[model samples]
Target: MSSNQQSDNVLSLRGISKTFGAVAALTDIDLDVAAGQVVAIVGDNGAGKSTLVKILSGVHPPDSGKIVFDSKTVEIPTPAAAHRLGIATVFQDLALCENLNVIQNLFLGQELRPLRLNDVAMETRSWDLLRQLSAKIPSVRVPVASLSGGQRQTVAIARSLLGDPKVIILDEPTAALGVAQTAEVLNLVERLRERGLGVIMISHNMADVKAVADTVAVLRLGRNNGVFDVNDVSPEDIIAAITGATDNAVSQRQARRKEGLSS
Candidate 1:
């Protein structure tokens, strides 16, 4: 894919490739994410979604690529470097301590006044972050384990915001969530866009993508298949790009049904 550098893009990846000994995980991937927009990355398993996320998250460096953040080419050698560059990634597992409350989890290592331990200040900041996201949690003092799936996701996302990141990458934000819970998470994603944060959501659910994403970036066999406007592209089109063919079962069934209708 061509990396057409747009002035509005907050994050851009060009010629991104990674290899693990004999296997090539990603090859010449290009993606762009603008401020206040949600870019959903969709692909089947082993399509290099996980590898791409790791590169952005600083878990693994790309073998070859250019990562431009905030209009400057930068290197993210560690998780700290990524955060320092205003890129925050919330993985599927969330990495929240079950025993800790919302306030504790939000400021886990980066607490206010580490020597003195400012409880009131941390609690106030936690409430402010949750309120900004319009998160629905009865109390910040409640243990993370007591929260529902959606609530936990809200907490994870809110915590990411504490760094005031220019871009946020969410891995499977609505996976395993019930219908209502999924809707809740989707609403939060919208809120992030409204806050003028560039969001890169990695999801398998096309419905959720259509609901909140402004653009969909599809990766097929570790290469760029297509980038589409969510408003113009159908879910089937995206799926075809993902699976690398239109002759698959879904498209074939739709084609046969269309033929029958025209007959």
Candidate 2:
């Protein structure tokens, strides 16, 4: 985590540690995300990035930690609990039904049926949500299979908003998109922040992180390597933290010299 902390964070985690029997997945991690902010979690493979996401999503309870949401410390023990606390997650596999239309997919599990199926209301809401994000979907009546990769991602993200969540966790949202598609999704992320929602994006794409993230948090070998303001740090330094490239003898010598100069 960074040495500085935000005074009005919507979500704050402290000393969060988790283990998987013999392997220590995460150790003493700290993170803060404020409303209208996009925090990107970047790490190399097996660097405990996914583990930390699971803990936050309530797929796995942390072995030790404190989780504060809206300035209140609370325990998230299940996915339902996380949802109840206004936390929503969109995993890499969008979980959308290709055979169903946009509206069908959006209200699949939680349909807005008072007496019978309210198709009109559901379809209208689907369009409203997509319009809010400025999504480029062709029609809300078309099957999801007919949509492009970016459109499918937009649908999944829009579905996560059904409950009016305050925080949204997106895992590799643009991992499989083309250049144009990636830009479309990134624009949606910006809109989410504009709506005052806290966004946590887990991605390996440094370019994407640097493009949209307000803060970039780097994890190295199950520990908090560093958290940087995206504008203040260079891509080279962020990559160094991800690969431990800055820990060599030459880098250490340079660090010592820089410290001596500062002293």
Candidate 3:
């Protein structure tokens, strides 16, 4: 939506809304993600970030909205459908099997050959995927549990790429990671963008958003609050949008100070 043509957007949502019993989780939300761009969705708790992610990931269908993918209106009825449509979501928990090695986890259910169990082929493809992201794993045969937080994230993201998805949704990708690990994940995000994949990064960390996202989309009380180019917008403005404090006491005080200085 930030000057990107509709044709360039790999995923777009219009009039997206969702309700749970009597609670309206989302209302009239609109978003756009162009290919090879990183758009960060930031909001306070209960601001409907999770609901919107679920809707796009096909966990829950929007009550009324149009989802345009590849310039075609489409309905993502299930997670599988979302994947089939080139939409991949990596949730915060990651869902990686700690007991399984990186290679085992990558091809858990989608191995190369069910009958033959092509370990060599799967390992080769896994290495190829990891190399594409410049992952820092010592060995693919090691248990994922032995990997660092950032390494695990790299494995999960690499697995998501196996399907050749056009759009990848990352939910709080740097959460619980150390500063070094966070930087590593952010670098991987840049690699994803370089690969020409649309990236929707949901995070509460303003620093992370500003560090990697091209645009920031704010959600307030389940509605579109504001969207801004990361380079053109300040972190304070983004936080103000998330907290719904754009015209609040602090801003009024700042405005008065500016007026007095100008006078």
Candidate 4:
């Protein structure tokens, strides 16, 4: 969430707090995702990154506060309802079945059926989506297991876009990929932004964050620390925010510096 992102917040989360029994997974989180921007959320282990995504994906509900999607504050209680509102989440696994063909995997649960399953229409629609996204997979009929990791990932993302989602949240997209595959995934993310869809990328790799993110948002200990334009801050500064080792990141490091002086 950059300063530029502050101007046109497509998604606004105000004081969103969530708890589980005695465990406070998130507290007082405020974030904004503007149109056509990819915001990366970086943090360490137990930083509550997964929990935050669950909240956005309708796996968990906030105990307090509000979430505004497309200017209207709303509550997302179920995955299907979230899909209806155009929020899609791609998990770490990419979630594609190896035995299935590209088109079969793409339209798995939501197969298009007129009187019966419309195989021709479904495959044609898949082809159209691949073309629209400019994805590089060669054949839609090939088994997913036969394709490279990057191509399989492309299928996962293409499936997400079928609903014309307003925002897409990607969880550790390149965590297990090789250097080449990582680059490919980053390029795909760039295409997502070019298509005007808001992107929330969760990664442990700052390198990946710096590569494709328009904005960087830090979550330390299940709380929003700060959000900044990628060009406005350094990687070290972002790390400081992630560890809460520096002063106040939300207030632009001034609060932390002033506190240091007073102390």
Q: What is the lDDT of candidate 1?
A: 0.94
lDDT string for model 1 (1-263, tens) is: 33554868999999999999988999999999999999999999999999999999899999999999888999888989999999999999999999999999999889999899999999999999999888899999989999999999999999999999999999999997899889999999999999999999999999999999999999998999999999999999999999999889989988999999999
Estimate, for each residue in 115-175, the C-alpha lDDT of model 3 and write its tens digit.
9999999999999999989999989999999999999999989988989999999999999
The Cα local distance difference test for each model comes to 0.94, 0.92, 0.94, 0.88
Superpose all Cα atoms of candidate 3 onto the true structure and report the RMSD in Å to 1 decimal. Answer: 2.7
Which pairs of residues collide in candidate 1? none
Q: Which regions of candidate 1 are displaced past 4 Å?
A: 1-5
Q: 189-259 in candidate 2: lDDT tens per residue? A: 99999999999999988899999999999999999999999999877688889888878665677789999
RMSD of each: 1.7, 4.9, 2.7, 5.8
Off by over 4 Å in 4: 1-7, 246-263
Lowest-scoring 10 consecutive residues by lDDT in candidate 3? 1-10
In candidate 3, stretches whose alpha carbon ends up further than 4 angstroms from where it belongs are 1-4, 247-263
Clashes of each: 0, 0, 0, 1
For each candidate in turn, the TM-score is 0.97, 0.91, 0.93, 0.89
Kindly list the per-residue Cα lDDT of model 4 for residues 139-242, writing each as its tens digit: 99999999888787888999999999989999999988889888888989999999999999999898899999989989988888889899998887898898
